[model samples]
Target chain A: MKVMRETIVSTARELFRSKGYAGASMNDLADAVGLKKSSLYVRFPNKEALVPAVLDLTLQETFGQRDSASGQWDDEFVEVIEFIATTLTDRGRCVGLHLAYGTSDETPIAKHAVRAFFQAHRDHLSSILSRAMPVDVARDIATDTLARLEGATAFVAIFGEKDAMKRAVRLSIEEAKNAAAAKSLSSR
Target chain B: MKVMRETIVSTARELFRSKGYAGASMNDLADAVGLKKSSLYVRFPNKEALVPAVLDLTLQETFGQRDSASGQWDDEFVEVIEFIATTLTDRGRCVGLHLAYGTSDETPIAKHAVRAFFQAHRDHLSSILSRAMPVDVARDIATDTLARLEGATAFVAIFGEKDAMKRAVRLSIEEAKNAAAAKSLSSR
Candidate 1:
């Protein structure tokens, strides 16, 4: 069923995020979900085929975690702050981005999937930032803010200092509000 | 000689930065400097050792690349903007941070070189940011700005577009300058 496929992909994604692509084995993935590697092949032709699916799940999980929370919560400040915290606070996600971002798409194996996953996210972020500022500038802020979160999260993961990461999130909120305040003032 | 080791590390760092950690193989590293991988290993025990040393080269090169055209070079704004640009604009330097930040010291194989590499920079950033801002707040801005640069650069790397990357860089410059301006107004 489609639900089972989703579960399988999600499990594989957790494994990949914890372990680097080169470090993660198919057998390990099979063992995690109680399904044989053979059974997985029906859903995923190979580990290579499964990688993109897993990455998609990871990105979706990341987005959903924020989108779901941000949807009901009407506070713009909390929405942006929590969205950043969710992305940066996790050890697994930080390491995962480094592994994923640093890879090249020279092989069909890595290319299209990487393109799809990031472009979709960028488009989504563009939407969020656009609400706060002009289209191009908002998109730029979204890209810049996301980049800071990604790199800073990696540092926090290694350093294990939530304070540093927290400081960063606060700084972002201030910048957004400050910029907005400055804009409102200029207009007035 | 120390000079030879420096040359090897510098060349390898540039290659690794542009080509990426995995994509830049030992053989290609050798080819870059017209040396054999074996000869290269004389200065560097292996990739593990080379990465740290290469990262040092990257930091040095980054600081060195800062324009010294003006005697006003030490101004906090100038220093931070250029430093942010080096980390954000260049794919290799971003990878240097990626590799360093993602690397764990749980094993002896894990190099702790990031401390020396990032500390001076972080400290330098804070020291400069504090010049015209609150100490605690300046520290936050420093981390936020650095993290933003890292994040924005990664986005550019993934998307590989000129306008987006350029806009991110421009915003980054503006954002830092704005923060400094905000800090100045608060002090007054």
Candidate 2:
């Protein structure tokens, strides 16, 4: 049942990515997963319940990359930064969550997930920033940096190409490095 | 009639920000500015046409800010870097281009404006990078920087607060400045 459930959710996510929420349908999701519409209901009570789960998986996977790096800059903090940047980029490409959060406040599921995601983002960045900068500075930078990254992704999704997206990531990471260094300098 | 037409588009932009694209309608737009539906049509062909014009105006204002910055940092290429960061920080606060452009990808109006935006972005960033770093590195950084900003913005829109967004921007700009400085040193 769990394997079947995962299949349904993953299929729905793929549909949502390729087609906007309005463009996709429960029937389509069911067809994509090789299940009857009724069977899909067995796993997913409805489109609303199912869509968030699909997106949640993607968000978790994208942010989850923090633990998986190996290279010259093996510091845990550096890896965290890299993971965050990649997560943002990946959201656009893989899940389109960056693009599809909502059409408005009425979108409760998207709103809930987005709010939760930001909360996690704030906590994660706060931890990193506190280590490298004053608490206030860290929090400010964290809020602004995350907001900028989100905006950038939205832009790239609408108008930017692959190369442009990649460039944004590189510069952002470099910025994090500079911030860390500057904090050390000022504190010393 | 043209004045009324422009008024409708202009007012719609504001409503879109607070009310969101999906939330507002032609009726609400008309009512907001004290006009009837038929009169509103004199200026805007439909909900769609009005959206683009309004978007253009907002984007124009944003780019306008870039043009008016202190002359000390007004060099064209350098300004593009500044533009990327600025756009990331407050795009949602604006009411035109981003709203229509970011809302959905199907609109032809958004398509043209966004394409033009990206083209200018590439040209400006390319020139600046060529001047400061090896062509490849410069190009890579420009694209990377844009992506990070976009990604960060997506994160903010989803999450609401923006600690991460602020940090990323501050850090990214500093890094870009340093990279430019280093390139100048090497040239000397």
Candidate 3:
């Protein structure tokens, strides 16, 4: 039963990514899961309930560990950008990020999920940035970097174009590498 | 009647900024405007219609001029950052930018408005940045700069705190200035 529920949620996450929260109907969800509509309701009372479940799953999958412990901030920055590009480019990912800002005024669930996502992202980026710069500067740089990524994500989500955003991501990675290199030179 | 319609749109813009499109009810809008809800509908068929009108007004007021004829790219960059800071921090602004990303999946109207907004913004910034660097480089810098600003705006919109985003704006301005100065030095 637990495995079935997990399967349902993972599938629903994909639906939400491709079709969006409002676009993905319960009927579609049930059809994807091969479950009767009534059985789907027995699990999730409404679409809203299903949405946060999908959010949780995406967050878990996308934000695991840095994994590239090359001990180089520049290398990690590039890896992080690569991860972001993959997630943003995937048609069926970052649904939570979309809905968090998209439906924030109307839905507490969305607002809560988005808030948690930003906080977690902020903390993670700040910690990573602190390795090369002062804590305060790192915090600012982290905020700036994440803002660029999210901005690019939002741009693609709105317009379905990746070229401009991809260019922005590349420019950001270059800037981070330069900053790190400059810091090392100054210290030397 | 036209004046009244304009007044309603401007007021609705404020409500949307403070409360978000989903949060601002017709009653709240009517109460703010000193009119009955029925009369409000006479001007705007529904809330969705009202939102785009507000977006038009904001774009007009905020982006009317690049007036920094001083021919200094650094001055213009600071002015642009200042403009963004004012727009994001204003108690009743940037609602369209937020809603564009937030309602993009569900509403074609939102998607259209956001796409136009981003395209216009990119054109405007690229034009300004071209004064400092080659056209291609200017376009990339413009894209990166706007993404950073939008991301910071989204961060503040979600978290209800402006400090991190504000810091990002400051840092971005400094970077732009330094970049422009470096380019000028190379050309010299």
Q: Which stretches of candidate 3 lie over 4 Å from their true place?
A: A1-3, A11-38, A45-52, A65-74, A92-94, A102-110, A131-134, A182-188, B1-3, B14-38, B45-48, B65-73, B102-110, B182-188
RMSD of 1: 4.7
> Model 3: per-residue lDDT, tens digit, B53-148?
877877777677656456776677667767876778665236755465345446677567767777777777777777877787776667667767
For candidate 1, write residues A49-93 as lDDT tens digits. 776877677676656656533552225544755764766586435
Reference-based lDDT, each prediction:
0.61, 0.58, 0.69
Against the true structure, what is model 3's DockQ? 0.39
| Pairs clashing within candidate 3 | A102-B102
Once fitted onto the true fold, the runs of candidate 1 whose alpha carbons sit more than 4 angstroms away are A1-8, A22-42, A63-77, A80-84, A128-133, A171-188, B1-4, B18-25, B64-76, B83-93, B106-110, B162-188
For every prediction, compared with the true complex, DockQ reads 0.36, 0.30, 0.39
For model 2, residues B134-185, the per-residue Cα lDDT tens digits are 7776665565555455555555556554555555555556656777788779
Predicted structure 2: lDDT: 0.58
lDDT for residue A98 in candidate 2, whole number 0-100: 26
Candidate number with the higher DockQ (2 or 3): 3
Per-model TM against the reference: 0.76, 0.65, 0.78
| Docking class for candidate 1 | acceptable
Residue A59, candidate 2: C-alpha displacement in angstroms: 4.1
Worst 10 residues of 1 chain A by lDDT: A68-77
lDDT tens per residue, model 1, B17-123: 65555456889888777777788777777777777777667677656565433333236455556655755665434655655543455423433676556665666
lDDT of 1 at A52: 80
